[model samples]
Target: MLQSRRRLRSRIFVSFALFGLALTSLFAAATIYMRARLEDQLINNTLQREVENFVQFKQAHPEPDAPWKLSTFDAQIYSARKFANVPFAWQRYGTGVYDIRDFDENGKLRPYKLAVYKDDRYWAFLRLDVSTQRLSERQLITALGFAVLIFAGLSMLIGRWLSSRVMSPVSDLARRLRSLRRTGQFEPLAPNFADDEVGELAAALDDYAQRLTELVQRDREFNADVSHELRTPLAVIATTTELLLNAPDLSDKMRDRLKRMERASRQSTELIEALLLLSRAERSGPIDGETTDIARVCADVIDANRPHLGGRPVEVSLRVESPLAVNAPSSVVAVALNNLIGNAIKYTPQGEVVVRVQDGRVLVEDTGPGIKAEDAEKLFQRGVRGEGAVGKGAGLGLAIVRRLCELYGWGVGLRPREGGGAVATLDFQPRR
Candidate 1:
């Protein structure tokens, strides 16, 4: 099964951070928009009212000008006969506020808002300078930018806090699971958590672990029972074969048959022991101050599998370029070598099967119909056979060999040989 590289806690934290940033950005933008809109409306309404009031005041006292009294604004009145006195830019506009920039008498640029109201006989203009308002707008923008930064920072801190709180139970569960793997103990997981999603997950894992523990226990007991029951009859056969071989009246052919029986019994016993170790997923180490002779085991396996040739002109040879001994059980070594040599013998029709032991590895090279490089690895899988496999077989021999090698921390692989054959290599780690 595949899993995510990123942790759930990290994803949650990032989601919260991004949401905070987006929310703050949106809020800041809306604030700026509303402030600008309301300011514009207020300024326009105040200017319009003032300009109208000035017109009404003029109309009420029509003798001397009410007062050329304008504090924040410059007011001007133009009669219909004095239309030319109105600024050409102001002459075209009617009865509304207009923002205008122009060169004044001092040859300097002046920006202002103009409020204009007109009738058939008179025109009223009110001008208000806006430099201070521009400065205020820039200040407001700067302030909002800082506010966005402050809130975004606060959001990040809050996200980290929430993630820690949310993931604490999950972290505890993981630590407990690691302890279980290291110590091989089972413990309930759900009771420590609240009634939440994490608690439900813990309950599910507890149930699965219990079922798996039971299944493994039963499998181990069955393997032990089978090994004990089968070893007794095999031990009897070995003893009987030795007794029958020692009889003085035994014929040469009868003695050879008894010797074959003894060899078969020994092979079966070794196979049983090796398989028991495999079933328990236990590695069988070498005895104290002793190591398994790889060359000797290869020779014995080659002799045992010669019968598989079925009278074909196949030559099986062993060459020890450099003697190798491994710190592992002889039976496991023997079982792994047997499959490699046996497969070579079965596949080679009329060629040579060379078993070479050197450099803490065994190389079985066979000159038969070679397998494709891609198909070599598949041959080690259970129930998988080569394209031109001969005779009846379950295709499990190589798979078992692979399992044994894996248990013992050894490496096994196959590749296409240069001279149209397959080369199987079983490399063992060097003993310390």
Candidate 2:
């Protein structure tokens, strides 16, 4: 639900950054590998040829003290004819180039490429010091590392700039969408964007918004008509019942029936008004200024729903722990409380239905078979009911309660109560 946790723009930018890092890192690694390979090849070929040339010269001169000058290379000659002249380590070698790291005559460890040339009479050895080559390799690595850093940083900056440009149209669409929703009107959005995915999405949204606006208008008008059409008859019924109750010889039974009829009429009128208000989804100015005594309304709701217990020995009671009031229509408050208290009474067969009114909330606790806490919220969805719910209920009472609470800026929730029961809470205070 918190969509801002990872945004599409962020993903795009990260992708660009990683691509740059990977490309540069791979190139630097390849450069280091190739440089090492070529340097090794050049040194091996040069040393092999020079050592073979030294053997040919030794065969021709055949002198122990001869001027043997060469480039940055060292040479040593051994007579294979005499087994004692060659060192035990060098005697094992054939005519080839080999890598060796060993102590020199001065007892200092050095790494070199060794070229050996041998025949029936001479064993020639040529070597090159690679310490300077190793230093060059180190300097190359450092330079490549710095190059990677500079390019990677530049890529990240480019990624940020590209992300902003790419997301500008989407951000504009969101801003315009919020504005249209606030004004309760929508216009074509496709015309404002290019012919791409964004344009396609805009076109789809425009169609949906137009349909939604029409549907809302029809619903509000229908609710208004229903309230208007139903009020007149409900009013007539109340008036007729009142006039009849005052007749000369009305029996106790007849008066009781008439009183019930009058109460039902009043209840119906209040329900219509509340439903109409909810359909409008607005404050209507009246409810926002009217301070309704919610404690009194809860008491009335408890009384009205008390008869739901039927012949059961259940006790239905309202406890006013403190006076409560809300800036909302009395009808809306009555409808919400009626559903809550009525459900509590209907569910609790034998124990108790308690409506507790506090400073800013109402709690309807009932001693019935409790539901799972996880299932409590699902009960408020339309056409959803408690498991194994018996009798004639469309399962919309709690749904209506939730809708009215939302419309009035209130909060309603249900949870399992301790000691085997369910608790329904209706909060009238505004959310922080």
Candidate 3:
């Protein structure tokens, strides 16, 4: 549809230009013809009048060398006719009877003839010459050429402007589609006038994007639910394996073997769950859930991780001052916050870990060696490192938090703390 629109616009522009050129050519030809016809008629009328006047003048004077002041029209016309090879002749043979014959130098009949009568007898004859009106033709053609040039220029400008106006929306749509192809996203449909074809295209693209977003969202939900469902069985297997390792009758060698097996089982279970959550987060669309207090969620997370941070001399501070709330599932929010606090506790050995609420966001900060620039970007990926400074970690803590944030439709990011260590934040849009 878009390509067709562009082609249509291009054709319109070309057609307009061609129409203008045709119009100009027609007008130029008409102008030239009219000018030449008018000039010919004027010159013919002037020549006839000049010939009649000269005959009358000669009859009144009756002498070839007679001196008479000629009128402006007579002087101009006669001089031009003379230079163009007009002919004159006179003959007298009887009383008061004289015959005159006028012919061109090449014996060609002239365009004009005149006879002078004196004493009831013809005494002299005159014939005026004719020449092609090349000068008049050239002037008319030049004027017509100028007019056509102006018209063609104006037509080109108008055509280009109108074409761009019609095609601009199509260009924008093409750019958007290209961008989507590159990034694997079809979002942010542009608005256009309903009366235009571009509007129809925009509406269609918007609909397609909406359907795609919904399908992706469904997949994300399915993955998240699958991860949660798998956790229970994994927990059972891990617990059973631990029991076998702790059997009293078993030999030391058998016990050691069982312990390794138990450890491996636990790790595998966590890894699987983490992988599922990561898949969910990467695929999910915007989150839609109940409005829950984010501050309260942060407080619960801090409390849950307190036992793990107990032995260390690390100080923990929490400031959930405002009525911070978010539009998200409470369970997902809880899970996200728990992972955040747990990561902070695991990384910080002796310094403070603070949970604060401000500007409608929940921030968990820990004092430890900050994440390296190289690792920071991948910190939220599945099975990626959550706590860079912490030596013993499965690197799924931040991954879980990232997935939960996606499910809840909140923005999450990691940044270096002002003093030291790193701060993970969940910036949520407040419920109205």
Rank by lDDT, highest first.
1, 2, 3
The best-first sequence of candidates by TM-score reads 1, 2, 3
- The lDDT of each candidate is 0.82, 0.79, 0.65
Which 10-residue window of candidate 1 scores lowest in summed lDDT? Answer: 1-10
For candidate 1, the TM-score is: 0.77
Which structure among the candidates has the greatest lDDT?
Answer: 1
TM-score, one value per model: 0.77, 0.65, 0.47
On residues 1-432, what C-alpha lDDT tens digit does candidate 1 reach at each position?
Answer: 112334555656676777678767777686778578758866776677668867777888787845645434788999978999998989999999998886654787877899999999999999987755765677667867776787678777777776775577788889888999999878898776666666778899999998998999999899989998999999999999998988899999898778778878878998999889988888868778589899989988887777668799988999999989888888888888888888778888888999998887999999989899889889999999998886788999889988998887788989988978889989897244
Candidate 1 yields a Cα-based lDDT of 0.82
lDDT tens string, model 2, 1-432?
112234455656676777678767767676767677657766786687678878877888889998776544789897767857776777788999988776755788877788999999889988876655666677677866776687678777777776776676688889889998798667788788766556678889989878987897898788878877999899999999999999989999998888778778878988888777767766543443768888788877776766567799898878889988777778777888888887877777789888898878889899987789889889999999887477999999999998987776789999999998899999888568
- In angstroms, give how far residue 384 of model 1 lies from its true place: 1.9
Model 2: weakest 10-residue lDDT segment is 1-10
